[model samples]
Target: RLAARSGLSVGRLKISVVTTAKYLIPSLLGEFCQAYPNIEPEFQIGNRAEIIQRLKQNLDDLYVFSNPPRELDITTDFLTKNPLVVIAKQGHPLKDKKSILWEELYGERLLMRENGSGTRYAIEAFFKENRIKMQNPITIASNEAIKESVMAGLGIAIISQHALNHMAPGNLIELPVHGFPIPNSWYWVLPKGKHVSNAAMAFREHVTQGLSHKKPNEHA
Candidate 1:
């Protein structure tokens, strides 16, 4: 709860965040809501391009982007380093292996996010750089759909570890991809020269301090 003595907006803080749909749905948003009921957050999950576009339009007080561009006209702060992981159905052929190679995934029926999605871009780049051949993926728009596809043994995918918690037991398995992880940092950005609202600033400080005090395991 916001301190009554603060006399801040204390009722609403419209935070616009751009991160993974997986994180927004069940992890980051949930924790934030539980901690600050007065703060109302609106999220738009998309690729770096979409997030940057929204920032340029002054549509959001804050944006949570992965790998935000250095040349953007915005102020930035680090949130967390998210590592990518490969996901597959349980009892998959590669499950018993300690790790799998990028080449090992060649010819696999991969599930992929739609174009313009940050997750899809990263996965595609990784495969291309390593010359790993993948079959035409069944493209989906949201993380939820992707998760459901993987759970049904439709195809495997590389996604943020945040989604692992929500996977159905004995239905989805995390595949260890070689040369994987491809660590990405979550960042908060604000438009240049624009002063932040009092409520937004309060929530920002709360989140910044909260992140600083977090145990490694909590973020990990």
Candidate 2:
């Protein structure tokens, strides 16, 4: 068949990812495409809930997540570390502080991702464990919006370090809050018992080999 003749070098590669992975997956995908110029990539970016819904429906060849859903019977490969850190506007009072306590955050306005976001879930669990109660936290849907709000002095937020990599210099700074960088990682998921296309297999190998060469923090 023509499909066999074209091989992995020419085919549709479908991938879906959580919004935070938007800052990371595109460039790697671009490199993959460069090596196989004839291949077409169908990339979808959504919040954790949306991506999970897509996964449930088996809509994509691969799915990327910082917080992989535990309820799903899927296979996950650890792609890279995605450390979540607290962030604030460049000139905030706590900017120069050291070993900031978790209780100190209680007095500050917390900016949160919308309902069903993986980042929000992780933050809420951490806060619950630490017995810190947020006061009327604001909910922003996208990472870009959250960063913008922080830059405008709206409030501090907890987000992946990868999100800050794409931001312009000198606009935002990570707060050295204790028990921070919530220890997260990106995962590549596949539905159980699903057939793996050659294109998908190739991409998985490309990502694994590519990321292996860089330091944990340099995955971006």
Candidate 3:
């Protein structure tokens, strides 16, 4: 409270976020820093499992992810949409189609993220809902790597739209999967009952104010 009341001398925060939000979250943090120029901010970028470990140790003021894990005793505020989309190399047979059925995807060799990735979970959940079984999927290391494999014509994959930054000119294209653009949102999560710092509290308010009206989950 003294640091916040002092209003410019000392404010610091620690934050950990999942990998896919690397580009967007940093920009938001930069905006927050402009108001508290001296705020010492620390960041860790990792996958979902790494983030869960960090949260267990209470490492950061906030944790961010697309799919919220229920195991954590945290309070989450929806920040923004993290829509998922299917992508394939340019000139793939489905490129010109506007709305391809999900069942149609079964015919194509699919590229997938590593076993523990959030994208993989999202993909699995979608398949499970429709009782669709995924055959052997080419396992890539990261979203960027998946894009690379797709560009090489390995197969198509679903990923957060933000990671589309990894695409090179005309190398890959978005395929219109019916009932796709999965309606998921990024959330700012803080463990309840933990000691919240003024800087951390301020940052929470900074983000929450913009999203107070959004529902916790998105739907079709």
Candidate 4:
């Protein structure tokens, strides 16, 4: 084990990340792997609760979360901003509206992530602080599914801006709702006092350098 931690080119890297981080982490991991060809990366993707369970068990060398679990004794590093935005299918009536009020969403069908989702938690907190109650929300388990549903014109959803990176140009449009693009960020987490593997450390350094080169808007 000690020998493994001392070498970066030939060891396994176990990384667990939340479902939302799926959009960003894989590409980063791909870059890291390309640079260190022999390093094996075990990437586990799950929703917030599942990832938290893995964190509690200390199951991986690293973990990623948009909203880190508050009760755990873990150390975290900011990876990138994960802004949540409101999106609706193209041609929707509200697409052209400017500075749409939060109240305007009250009548529209809202698509939500399942309970225990970091995005849902953030959105719920925002709604509570604003005294807004979702009239009737459709709970979906994955970000991809929610995006598909939104594109199908089922309803509008609040999702990470990164999720929009690979989307087609006109399938969906971001809503001009006030207080939108809720400010959030992805973090790299590890149990407090945990041993840092060399491969994991290398990946961290790679992410830092990679993100530094990105323009501000490109972060989303």
Candidate 5:
């Protein structure tokens, strides 16, 4: 009953989506827009710094990201927990292995995200903490590009499992690694102590319901 009434109003709501272009650019945003056709979604695809700056300037109504700052004057809600996985070509020698160790990646050519990318930061931190020596053979900015490069046999990379659905058939293979599996949280942030617009609130509820309705028996 509420779902049909939520997005009917044409209140102009401005949303600033922060995060990688992989998830938001088409998938999430496309569905969100379909639910609330009147509300406009603006995206600022960059590192965390850009999103923080936008929030500081009151330029955004909401922030969609993997992580939000601890001290920001924002209300937050947990959205999803995404796990990190290593990826290579399907026929790559590593695919046959049950599991790979951090040390096993040493000297392997890697296609990596640039500095300031959250995924790259998390993976690098994991490697540093475990004292793993990894080779950075190439660096790119977008997940799509990195996935394509890895599929082309340019190098292997660590990426979110959620993004694997977008990769090619028998092209990029996700490798299960022992002592690895970087889990990260995705969140929604809104201004603290301020009333969120009806349109924005509706969008939030729509997304929440959508996620909540995902059945265990269904394929993602």
Candidate 6:
């Protein structure tokens, strides 16, 4: 009886997410909190492998990812589209070129996300399918760090456009590399056959309805 009352009186919504969704989910969560101010919202952010491990252990209420783990028994509800693109510091030689080729990007120094990152996986998949061996690339963990490095002209990187939205205008601009704007989405993920709490279920519905009203090409 007490637990039920607590669930109603002070709902707790726990969420886990890959870094790409880090920029968007918080704003949505903020809106949810206003409607349920007493609700305690907990968040866990990590690379794909770590987040999936927690899901295997049933650690939290919900999980978000851009690249869903294959062959895993999980319930996936598509939340929002996440566009991934290549970006470089403003004023780079390739900055002004509108029509660019993937082959051209190969010769330039590249920066990549750390291991087990969904962004890194997507980048690798692109290279694999094209049969292009990625030249020596620098690996950086933090999304912001990658942007900063690119701004310093350290190296260009493939990053989620969601992260790019938060950067100052003109500081980092998308490079129109071939086959870009890689189609990806943030998913409301759950462990298959596991019990989902009422609060989580409510938030899932909230997210679904909220996204349905959005334009197809809306920025994250």
lDDT of 2 by residue, 16-107 (tens): 99988887777677677777677798999998999999999999999999889989999898888888899999988877888898677777
Tens digit of per-residue lDDT, candidate 1, span 39-98: 677656666677767777888766777666668777887777666678888888988988
Top lDDT prediction, candidate number? 4
My TM-score estimates for the predictions, one after another, are: 0.80, 0.91, 0.84, 0.92, 0.83, 0.89
Best by TM-score: 4
Tens digits of per-residue lDDT for model 4 on 169-191? 56988888898878999999999
Whole-model lDDT, candidate 5?
Answer: 0.69
lDDT of each: 0.68, 0.83, 0.75, 0.84, 0.69, 0.80
Model 3: how far residue 202 lies from native, Å: 2.9
Residue 111 C-alpha lDDT in model 5? 82
Overall local distance difference test of candidate 1: 0.68
What's the lDDT of the predicted structure labeled candidate 4?
Answer: 0.84
Model 3 regions more than 4 Å off:
1-11, 165-168, 205-220
Comparing 4 and 6 by lDDT, which wins?
4
- Residue ranges of candidate 6 with Cα displaced over 4 Å: 1-9, 212-220
Residue 58, model 6, lDDT: 84
- lDDT-better candidate, 1 vs 6: 6
Model 3 RMSD vs true structure: 4.6
**Backbone collisions counted per model:** 0, 0, 0, 0, 0, 0
Q: Give the alpha carbon lDDT tens digit for every residue of 28-134 in model 6.
A: 66567766678798989999988989888888988998888867989887778887888988887887887788778777889888999999888888778877678
